[model samples]
Target: MTTSLGATATAASSASAEPGPSTPAPADELGVRAARIRSAELEEQIRTDPRRFRVSTGDRPTGRLHLGHYFGTLHNRVRLQDLGTELFVVIADYQVLTDRDVADDLPGHVEELVLDHLAAGVDPARSTIFTHSAIPALNQLLLPFLSLVSVSELGRNPTVKDEIAHSRQAAVSGLMFTYPAHQAADILFCKANLVPVGQDQLPHLELTRVIARRLNHRYGSGGVPVLPEPEALLSAAPLLLGTDGTKMSKSRGNAIALAASADETARLIRGAKTDSERHISYEPATRPEVSGLVLLTALCLGRDPRQVADDIGGAGAAALKAAATEAVNEYLAPLRARRAMYARDRGHVRQVLREGNERASAIAETTLNEVRAAMKTLY
Candidate 1:
């Protein structure tokens, strides 16, 4: 089933982390509007020459992607690809070990991740999709980049701090501490100039810029250039809190996976936390639970959360949940259908990955050769 994506998904961030929008706006007037405005402006810029814009976005492949991933990053990816931007989607299988102990399920995990990407309308023909471990040049690039960053600098990355707290890991892995460097390798290898991601990842993207500048300054001291400093293309995904009124993560058991069945989606939304208040309103500060449901409903239906709350005026929590469930099921219907088809065809998926690996290796090899030459190690 070849999914020809015409328009990208329009899931603006509810920006909800804990049953409320990330911004302090009234639940009715949250991140959705601002995100949409920004996104539209970015889309307008897509008509620029494609060669001038390259994008790199990837996932850890810890598990299959979810609705969060769709609205958060996947939607914009298609738009970028359509605009003729050189794109590379990396399956960061190695990064999963930062918190995970075993690779017992890594192979299946990587396959599932790629399946979700393709099913979501990531055209392998347009975008280079490859696994991180398969790109040996990226691994080689990491060591030299590490010398450019220090322990103190790495420790100051806010995103890393947040991830550590989220992971609840008492002992941090050395690899985890240096994750930004590995990520920089991915972006710099492709010389990607734009990366679409959620706001939470801004710091990591900033780190990539720092790495590129440092490398160009030191290695390209003679006004030569090796790496391109990348910029973040933040998405407009309105925050969609998990059913539990917290961050939507698989570990937290609150995330709604992209491939979740209609029935499963209904079940999860039905069980989502909501206040006992018999009437729904957009008061996020006091009624975070209800506000999150409203925000989620707005995202699925492409309307303002405040409007959703008004539509459900005087409706009880149960009614609110039912409405949200219906909206989500409707939004996910086509995606799930395509996903089912991809899941059944493992042979085809493997072939796609194999091709992606080769293409990505060639690209990375070209970059590595340049880096070696710059460092006077071209022997």
Candidate 2:
């Protein structure tokens, strides 16, 4: 089943680690509105003093990233880094096992993830990129965080439910069932004050917000919260659809991997689903498939989708595909070159990860110490 634009299973930061909002409900309206208002406030604060915000965002190493990731959150990450916000980009390597039993070629996937970050203009010096497994203290927060939420709350999470249904797993693993706590650990471990996410992931963020408040109320020495309540940094961009006109997901085999060759990109776009109409127009409600293609093309060319459609008016699906293919390939060429260059030097990639792991481990250790002190667990 295809996911709606506002309710995809993936999120901006932990798209790989936790299940996101995949279903819509009336109850979420108030939370969504509140998040939007907070996001606007955060944006204003960021422009004035970007250094004040610490953002925790990342992806799972399930597969190489695609256009959806690039346009959705990757650019935002780089922008935040340039703006002076401290960023913790976790690879969430262990989160892969939440649903699947094994992570095939796990190390390789992690390396590729770093390469994508580097190629996408994410300065490693400005941000910390690390894997989940490398930081034991980070995972230690999970047990405390899990204690804050009830079993029913975990089961009721829309993101987890959608992920379980999508995974088609007959039995849910403990890790998958408690995915929100794991995500809370991810955010609060670094004490991230902001998390970039989509509308659907607001529920997951709400859980994190609750965890922060509960921990503070229960364990704080005075009025200060041990963890700051993180606000959602909602993206204004619409979610990109897959070539099949469904949600853009690597698991569905409908996405174009960033590592794909120019020829491969062209071939994929050529096979993209478009309507039977000969004239192209940007009407997402009426012509989703065709409009998706136009949007992709416009994202690459930095132009408006409607204008792109207007330029290609009267041209059939073939013309639309050609335009998208050319635009995407051209836009991604330099990034691909950087990726290839980095891929060749495996040693350098390893060094980047090693440094990142060390930095993250140190921070996790410090955070864990604080938690232990707050809980009076220090022996």
Candidate 3:
């Protein structure tokens, strides 16, 4: 459960404080401010129709999760669970089949990934958790869903293009190509009404909505639609950069794990990239390095990244680095302890996932029956 400093640094950096605007507000302020705006929208949604809000989001267990995953989605997932909405967190282990290279270790990796989730505060007791491999009925829903979506539509998805460019695979597998359909199945199987997604993922969610609409139009008899049109609850999380001052990613070696030890965390932060400029400012365009430190400070302290940047204004980059390191360590100390406790009880983590899978499967079974009955596929 202990995240490596490498894994947690991105999250810490995301929490960094930023400098305020001289005339208006700093560029770094834009992300947090935008998030506030979006948060208000979410609050209104919850207030207006609490019963209509059910969130389903998942991660592909290809590797260990980084701080980006924590702040970007995991934290939000925890908050949504507390809001009394039905939450479904999936470990998309089967999605790993898209890359044949990692196919062999998928099962073990899924377990480790689950452990990471527990360490990061995804409570299985309150929220349902399941892996794609464990939910056969859900996977079965993929074929009919696929028929509803066109191949050209899948080919046109921006994410598919990005993945093709980034992936090592020379040719995209059928699973990789049809990932959106699988995603549709994931959402519809549980009839999830809300899906928390990043801006980049909006298209995928849109496709899910399209598929749901198509299925309902084609199959609806006298009763209601089998699937609900899932709405996208876009996240306003700031883009966190890696130690190299680039996008934080596991593949890039710039990411810090969520469960890293204190010593490792300190070392990673110490080695983080910063501008040569003596003074700290949150100018993302000009001073990305120093700005990164400022942003990290803001997120950790729950203050404006701009404010943090201004507080250390005129202070040398050395001072900013020191402040950033101290702020990150302070924030992560308690998390590290909690992660350690969870890590020690590995069996407990498995049990949580197993129990979650049972809960999720029960729901999946009921939904599948309804789906099959609607399609007249019931024997």
Candidate 4:
């Protein structure tokens, strides 16, 4: 499902409102609006005379993606791909070690995640999808990145704090503490100029900028900088909640996986919680449960949540639930069928991943080589 130019422009303008982090109001608002206008102009520039401005983003392959993932990140990725940008989609398989107790099934999980991407219409030919573990050079860059960043700085990362709080292990592993550095490596190793990130991840991206600056100061004596400070391409999609009206997550059992069957989707929607007041409305604070349903319907049907609420006027929770269920199921049917076909043809999925890894490694190696040359570590 492609977003229209008008919709993309609107989304870009509203991107400044993403949750978390305080941004400069006037500048952020202006920048977001400018980004929308620039995006159109940039597309024209690329068509007339292509220039290299890469985008790299990823998710940890801990589990299957849900509708929240679709409406939030994946949808935007597809849109960006269509805009003639050099796109790289990483499956951060190594990052999963930060919280997961065991790693025995990681390979299988990564394979499943790749299948999910393909089934969801992520063109393998147009985008490079690789597991983090596959790129040894990229991971090697993490050690140098760690040396560039301070421990005090790492401690201040909110994402790290959140992960440490939720982790079962009392002692935060080196891997967990240095994830920001690894993220820097992921971006720098590809020389990505634009990173599609949510607002909450701004600090991490800021860290990447710091690393790039430090590296350039130390080694950019008479040549091009080895790394580029990637700019954030913020998303404007609303935060999608789970059936329980909480953040949608696999551990919480609130997620409806992208590959879920029709029956499973129906059952999950049927069991979704709603308030005692029979009437449907979009009062998120007062009625999160019903509001969540409204939000879901809006995202699935590409309608405004407020309009959905108005349409359901005197209709009670039952009518709203019925409408939401039908909308979600109808929206997911084709995706579900595609997912099943990919699931059955495991060989095809593997081939896709193998090809993606090769392509990703080729691009990543180019950046790594430049870094080594700049650092005088070519030996």
Q: Against the unseen true structure, what C-alpha lDDT does each candidate score?
A: 0.79, 0.85, 0.77, 0.79
Runs with alpha carbons beyond 4 Å of true place in candidate 3: 1-42, 48-51
* Whole-model alpha-carbon lDDT for candidate 3: 0.77
| Candidate 4 backbone collisions, by pair | none
Off by over 4 Å in 1: 1-43, 100-102, 166-170
- The best candidate by TM-score is 2
Candidate 2 CA-lDDT value: 0.85
Sort the predicted structures by lDDT, highest score first: 2, 4, 1, 3
User: What is the per-residue lDDT of model 2 for residues 18-130, given as tens digits with 9 covering 90 to 100?
Assistant: 23488554566657767778887988899899999999999889878999998888878888888899999999988787545338688878888999999998887889999
> What does the lDDT read for residue 242 in candidate 2?
93
Write the residue-wise lDDT of candidate 4 on 139-223 in tens digits. Answer: 8888778888899999888888998888888798988888888888888888888887766776778799999989988888776
Provide the lDDT at 44 for model 3.
79
Off by over 4 Å in 2: 1-27, 98-102
Q: Please give the range of 10 consecutive residues that has the lowest summed lDDT in model 3.
A: 1-10
Better of 1 and 3 by lDDT: 1
lDDT of 1 by residue, 208-310 (tens): 9898899899889668678888766766555556888876787778889998888898898888888777878876667877887887777777776677888
Candidate 4: RMSD to truth: 3.8
Candidate 2 residue pairs in backbone clash? none
TM-score for each model:
0.87, 0.92, 0.87, 0.89
Give me the candidate number with maximum lDDT: 2
